[model samples]
Target: MAPGEPAEPETAVVIATSGSTGAPKGVLLSARALTASAEATHARLGGPGQWLLATPAHYIGGLQVLVRSMLAGTTPVFLTGTGFRPDDFAAAAAQLTGGPRYTALVPTQLVRLLDDGGAGLAAARTFDAIVLGAAATTPALRERAAEAGVRIVPAYGMSETASGCVYDGVPLDGVHVDLADGRIRIAGAVLAHGYRLRPDLTADAFADGWFTTSDRGIRHDDGRIEVLGRADDMINTGGVKVSANAIERVLCAQPGVRDACVVGVADPEWGEAVVALVVPAGEPGDLRAAVRAELGPASTPKRIEFGAELPLRGPGKIDRAAVKTRLQPGSHG
Candidate 1:
């Protein structure tokens, strides 16, 4: 079911997470929880600013935009069926002459706007705030957007917490953030009741009145939380658990690598070996030296594949399954 659609009073709906690691779990969000989440998000985002609908409405990001607009008493400008060019977005965003204009964009959309250049960057600079969600916002992207004078807030949350309960890695107003055993724990009005049809998962996930996130994180000394990566994505090679997202972060920092996805390949001895799928900006070879210099040998990918772009799901996150499929025969088996 598409996000923001009027769900049955207490009926179950399936919502897919990014599914970068394993299978996508069909999360059942009730209408009540959905309503509560939308209302809470609207309240936190300063009461339903004008929304530019870029991401697919089937995803939570798109669904929340519609719900937030409804709560704010405004209609979101649909970018779908209108084309996805930066100029198209600029024209639409420019035409928004209503209450505080805001838009939710994934990192790729934001980057595309910047790359489209000309009026595109200028257009993006004019939002009340441009929220970056679904994936980690690189320092480079953040710096560029900030330089362009955009209020670029890096958001944190997932399908469970109703999109994002944290902005700039900090918990939203009225939301409680805690770290237990390096996992992110959240509790507040914004939190969903529980996942439907998965009572065992609900019990295991929500503990002590707080929903425990799959992300491994730590509360900073300054009170902000940094999500390290998904607990399941960790690869234990020779008794060492290496974070795939952590490795991707380092690899993505190199020039010519527009994107990076690190995964663990089964090995007879080490149990798992790290392999990287890179979307090259220029030359794939240049990234190898950069990885060696920056991430060191252990973290350096045993194999690197350059391609047009990484396979992405609804929100432009790397599709790890597709990446694994690209490996040499018998590499993963």
Candidate 2:
């Protein structure tokens, strides 16, 4: 499709998946589906007012901000830049002129804003609600943002769902969430029609009125869903299973660690070894002890590597594949 070209008939929007895990697929969403999602979000959010666009326009989260703004009969304030800075976000957020102000952001952007700690913190407090998505938000980050007077709604969904159908582990109106074989499955009016020009892929992902996600999750007794991690992200070491995300959460909460990415590397002894890439270059500080305390010795990372920063792909998600490649023996010169 050419730039600025209109979408195909009956298609409200065409969004490309981040392809962080695999090849990117073009998701075809209809007008009804998008409107349903927007309406449900507004109902849950106490009705939409003004939106601040801090994320890139190409991604689903950013695009939904625009869609909701249009539906609410309001103009969204755009933060113009290739990089996200606290000052820029503050300036843009100051432009919101009414009550019930809203915006969407990924977890990484929230961390950066918290780190800035001046005008950025003040600006973040102005939003009535900020939808955090595209990646999981660490519990430590959430606590910090709350202490700063930020109302964060951690969202979960993909491009295939038109946007977020679940907010803070609760399914929005008209959305149904279930666990099938430990994988999160969604069925609702917000689902996309199918992937554009990829019938086989669509057939595999969506069936029986439920869209099967690659993420593994468990529904709590209180009716809240807890997403564990991607099913494919599980590591097997000495025949024991470990969740990369589970280890990462513990590492990120520790002192002196800015961020962390965990991956499984080939090891002749263990079959696969759990490895960690930590950011900001500091002493790891008993990470093995920490992991063993929480998840036992089998799940502890075998090696810890320090780096200035973890490589990110789209929308601030840690690029695990890139990190694994860089950690290989002969990959570094």
Best by lDDT: 2
What is candidate 2's CA lDDT for residue 52?
94
Clashes of each: 1, 0
lDDT of 2 at 238: 98
Best by TM-score: 2
> What C-alpha lDDT, on a 0 to 100 scale, does residue 105 get in candidate 1?
89
Q: What is the C-alpha lDDT of each candidate?
A: 0.75, 0.87
lDDT of 2 by residue, 49-130 (tens): 8999898878888888888998999999999866988999989988889768999998888988888898987899888899
Worst 10 residues of 1 by lDDT: 1-10
lDDT of model 1, residue 73: 84
lDDT string, candidate 1, 64-117, tens digits: 888788877887887744536788787778778787788988888887887777
Candidate 2 pairs with clashing backbones: none
Model 2: residues >4 Å from true position, as ranges? Answer: 1-9, 280-284
Give the lDDT of residue 72 in candidate 2. Answer: 95
